[model samples]
Target: MTQTGSYLYAIAAPVGDDVLGGLRGVADEPVRAVRHRDLVAVVGTVDIGPDGPFGEEALAQNLSDAGWLAAVARAHHAVIDGVARAVPAAPLRLATIVADDDGVRDRLERWQDGLRRTLDEIAGHAEWSVKVHAPQPADPDTDPQPAAGAPGAGAAYLLRRKAVATARDDALARASAVAGQVHEELARHATDARRLAVQDQRLTGADTPMSLNGAYLVPVAGADAFVATVEELRERYPDCRFELAGPWPAYSFVTVEEP
Candidate 1:
């Protein structure tokens, strides 16, 4: 028989039983709450046998499988996202597992203060994602007609190449400057901002190069205005492509132990 472990999804302020009703977590197990003092931990039972997906040895192997990882991640996020909709919850890192309910309570007791602070910090805020991509500048047109076989022709060709390279660099610098301005303007409308590494074109499958990958923490009351600002920036900078996604749980703003 497979041994079971508790998969912790999130720590939240006290929540009603209905909040967990109809929710299925990793392994399709029903999610339940374990309360300790003023906090509740949302968890579900998962197998921890040597061959089971959540087992220490098996988990490392399973993470290498993209399809399996995606399905499990969706289930984990689904549970926390559902709870966040009705209460202030701090999501645990993906794959947080313990021996059993007693272990979960012990964690709650140990981390209650930090968890409470995190929940308070994100109580009425949501994370917003914004990406700005700019088309790569075209290479400078070169007139390579330097009279082949003529004196100094080789030197002229080298000069043209250098000029072309310089022009491209300058154009990229200008585009980078514009991206900075956009981020600064958008930051004005948010409570907090985080700049993420820009994704590669191959991964994004975008024809243009990304200039900015940013996440913002915005109050619910200001969500509409924040979205409007994004649209306005999009129009103001016609050269850049803008992507906005929002009203999500504050995943980027919280810090939790992954191990």
Candidate 2:
């Protein structure tokens, strides 16, 4: 028998009954809200039995598969964004599961006051992601053209390689310094800021390695200003490109355990 569990995504206050009408969650199951007092928990059923996609038996394997993780994350974010847009909420950690709706209600009741305060902290803010990348050296196979005044072989080639290495190091150092400045500038206009670990090009789909991966909690009212500042950053750092995404569901700003 396939045993199912309730997966919790976010918590809000008295969410509209019809808010999740057409929404789906893990495994494409219909989403519903579990309520206790004046609070509601957005939830959906996820199988936790052997052979189930999200089952504990296969949890490690599933996490190792990038495609599966991405699909699930997308679904989770879609529902979270929907609820956040309609009303303020505190997004739960990824893949938080409970045995059933009763478990969901119990947990919500236990954490009611703390969770409410978490919601209040992020009431007027959304998270925005910013990344900066420094371009990599041109590929030799595809371009076949090295920097002007190229060295063919022998002593000149060795010296050229040494110089190239030094230049690359310098560029990376400069990129790091600039990334710090960018974060400081953005943080000035944000309620709070968090510097996430830099991401690999493979994960970010960027042309160069990332120097900064930051998330800023910008007020909903000041979202336009945040975006404008990002544009200014783009111009300010020509050697390193900047990318901005979201008005995301206050994911980075809320913690259920927070005071």
TM-score of each: 0.88, 0.87
Q: In model 2, which runs have C-alpha deviations exceeding 4 angstroms?
A: 135-154
RMSD of 1: 2.7
lDDT of 1 by residue, 1-259 (tens): 8899999998998888898997999899999999999999999999999978888999998988999899999999999999988998888889989999999999888887788788898998888999988746666665655697899888888887887778767656766877899889988998889889999989999876788999998989999999999989888887667889978888887785533
Stretches of candidate 1 exceeding 4 Å from the true structure: 142-164, 256-259
For candidate 1, the 10 contiguous residues with the lowest summed lDDT are 135-144
